[model samples]
Structures are given as C-alpha cells and as structure tokens.
Target: MIIRIIDGITEFTGKLCAWTLFAVGFFITFEVLMRYVFNAPTIWVDEISRVLQVWVVYLGAAYVLKHREMVTIDVLLSNPNSVWRRLAETLAIIVLFIFAGTACYFGFQLWLKATMAGHTTDTYLAPPKMITHAPVWVGSALLMLQGAAQLYRVWAEPLPSDDVMGGAH
Candidate 1:
C-alpha cells in the first residue's frame, strides 16, 4: 500500500518535471532566433533555460530510477537470478540512499539560509534563490522516499523478471 503511494507520487513528479525539457528547448530556440533574426537578445532566456534544466535533473531523478533507466555498469545486471545482480542492486540502493540523505540534509540547510535572508539570484531578473534551492531539498527527499520503496521492491519481489522500460523501441 505504502509503496504504491510512493510510486504514484514518483510518477506524478517525474512526468511533470520531465515536461520542463520542452520548455528549456523552446526557450533556447527562442533566444537563438531573437539574437539572430530579431537582433534583439533577451536576458531571461539563458537563465530560465538553465533553471529548467536543473529542475529536470533534480526533480526527475526518482523517475529515472523507477523506470530503471539510470546509468548502470550492467555487468552483473545482465544475467538475472544470480547473486551478482542482487548484490549490485543492494549496493546501488544503499549508495543512493546515502547520497539522497546527505543531499537532502545539506540542501535543506542551504535553502533555509537563503530563504531566511530573502536571497535572490545575481541575474538581471534577480529571482529568489529559494526557487532553485527549494527543489534541491524537495526533490532529494522525494528521491529518498522512492529509494526506500525501490529497496523494498528489490528484496520483496521475485527476480529474473523481464525488465523493459517505456522507450524500449
């Protein structure tokens, strides 16, 4: 029940954040066209696109994991129903748990500091630093949740199942 809830949340967050890639691409293209054709460069495009990319990475991490699309060595995972595959999966989950915990802790502290001071970006628009920093902690926490669920799944579920993702074409 709880794992399903966590998975549902992960799916929602991942898909929503994944769409930001389109926004990033559109913004960059708009900037290029404005700079070349219109000859009037916009100041916000670069920063906005960069921010969107950061979000896509930070927010979409758990989605990548949930879909089993993360970068892997694949030496052990290639052959299922083996000790090596389970070992690799356990190690990966432990590493991810530690990383997500540390990131969430530090990211929260930094975000708190920035928010308390009412900090803003150094860009021309000077958007709030909280906007970017907030997602770091938020997304890290979500990733941690999904990691726990994945860890449970690794042990609880039967192995040797065919694992194919959405874009398997």
Candidate 2:
C-alpha cells in the first residue's frame, strides 16, 4: 500500500517534470524569435527558463530513483539469488538513504537560512532564493521516502530473476 502510494506520487511528479521540458523549449524558442524577428527581447525568459530547467532536473530525481532508471554497473549483480548481489544491493540502498537524507537535511537548512535572510536573485524580477531551492529540498525528501520504500520492498518481497529488469518481469 505504501509503495503504491509512493509510486503514484513519483509517477505524477515525473509527468509534471516531463511537461516542464516542453515549457522550457517553448520559452527559449519564443525568446529567440522575439529577439531576432520582432527585435524585442524579454528579460524574464532566460532566468525563468533556467529556473524551470533546474526544477525539471531536480524534481525528476525521485522519479528516476523510484523507477530504478539511474545508471548502474550491473554486470556483476546479474544473478538475483546470489549472496553478493543481495549484499551489493543492500549497500547501495544504505548509501542512497544516507545521501538522500543528508541532502534533505542540509537543503532544508540552507533554504531556511535563505528565507530568514530574505535572499533573492539579483535579477529585476528578484524571486526568493528559497523558492529556487525548494525543489532541491522536495526532491531530496522524495528520494529519501522512495529509498525507504525500496529498502522495505527488497527485504519483504522476493528478489527478481536475472531476466527481470527495472521491476518488470
């Protein structure tokens, strides 16, 4: 039940991030056309698009982790029943938990500091830095949650066979 909920959240967020890519492209293309053809350049395009790109990448991280789509050297862990494979997988999950948890902790701290200090971007639009960093905190938190779910799944469920890939049989 918990895993299903997490999977649903990750899937939804991934779709949203995928849509943002289109927005980024549209903004860039519009900005270019406006600048060259119409001789009018908007100040917000570059900054906004950059911010959106950052969000798309960072926010998509949890989706990537949840789906086990991240790059891995799986040559040695081909056999699911091997003791070495289980050990390696356990170690990797532990590392992911630690990394994601630490990032969430520190990212929240930095975001808090930025919020308290009233830090804003130097651009004319001057959006708060905390707003920008929110995605980092969110992504890290989601990663941590997903990592815990994955750990639970590995321990509670049967291991996949060599033919299975990315949680698919």
Candidate 3:
C-alpha cells in the first residue's frame, strides 16, 4: 500500500517536472523567434523564462533524489563485498541528510524573506517575486521530506530492490 502511494507520488512529480521543462523550452524558443524576426522583444519573456527555469531545477531536484539518480562516486561504494556496500550506502544517506537539511533551512529563510518583502519583478507583466520564490519553499520542503524518508528506509531495513535501484527491471 505504502509502496503504491510512493510510486504514484513519484510518477506524478516526474511528469510535473517534465512538463515544466517542456514549458520552459517552448517559451524560450518563442522568445528567441519573436525577438529576432519581429524586431520587438517580449518584455516579460525573460522574467517568465527565469521563473520557469527556477521551477524546473528545484522541482526536478526532488524527483531526482527520490529516484536516487543523483550522481555519486559509486565505484568504491559498489564493492563486491556486502559489508562495504552497505557501509557506503549508509554514509551516503548521512551525507545527503546533512546537505539537504542545510539547504532546506536556508531555502526556508529565503522564502520567508521574500514573502515579507512583498516584492514583484520589475517588468511590464509585474510578476510577483513571491510566485518566483514560492517554489523554493515547496521544493526544499519536498526535498527535505524525501531525504528524511530515504534515511528512514536506509536505517530501518534493507530497501526493496525495486525501490532502491528503481523499477528498471
């Protein structure tokens, strides 16, 4: 039951991230063509693209971590010996927690500051800075939550092969 829920959430997040990437690409391409061919650059395109890029990155980060696809030097960790492999996995989870925790803390702070400032982007479209920054809270919180969950899975029991290595098979 829990596995199914996680799988659904992970898949949804992945699709969301992919859609965001596509949107960013589309907007940027449109902006380039409009600027070069029409002789009138979009006033808000840059801001919109910037915002989309930020969303793509932070949101994608959580999905990446959830899948354990983030790069690591696994040559040493993938030792043939089970003990060494387990140790390396444990160490990696610990390090990930530390890094994720720190980033979440700071990301929250930045989000709070932006919210308090009540600022918006200086453009004709007047995009809210809060809108741009809102993802920081969502992304960091999700990343932190996923990090804790991963740590628990790492510590409590051996991850199911399908879960740990991904359901590639």
Give the winner by TM-score. 2
Q: Give the lowest summed-lDDT range of ten residues in model 2.
A: 160-169
Local distance difference test, candidate 3: 0.70
Instruction: Tally clashing residue pairs in candidate 1.
Output: 0
Instruction: For model 2, give the RMSD to the true fold.
Output: 2.6
Give the per-residue lDDT digits (tens) of candidate 1, residues 71-122.
7666446765567787788899999989999999999999999999999998
Judging by lDDT, tell me the better candidate of 1 and 3.
1
User: lDDT tens digits, residues 1-169, model 2?
Assistant: 8889998888899999999999989999999999999999999999998888888887898888777777667687887767787777788988988887888888899999999999999999899998898877888888877877877767777666545455652
Model 2 accuracy (lDDT, Cα): 0.83
TM-score head-to-head 2 vs 3, winner? 2
Candidates in descending lDDT order: 1, 2, 3
After TM-score superposition, the amount by which residue 56's alpha carbon in candidate 2 deviates from its true location, in angstroms, is 1.5
Candidate 1 C-alpha error for residue 87, in Å = 3.4
* Models ranked on TM-score: 2, 1, 3
Candidate 3 stretches with Cα past 4 Å from truth are: 1-7, 79-81, 152-169
Every candidate's lDDT:
0.84, 0.83, 0.70
Extract clashing residue pairs from model 2.
none
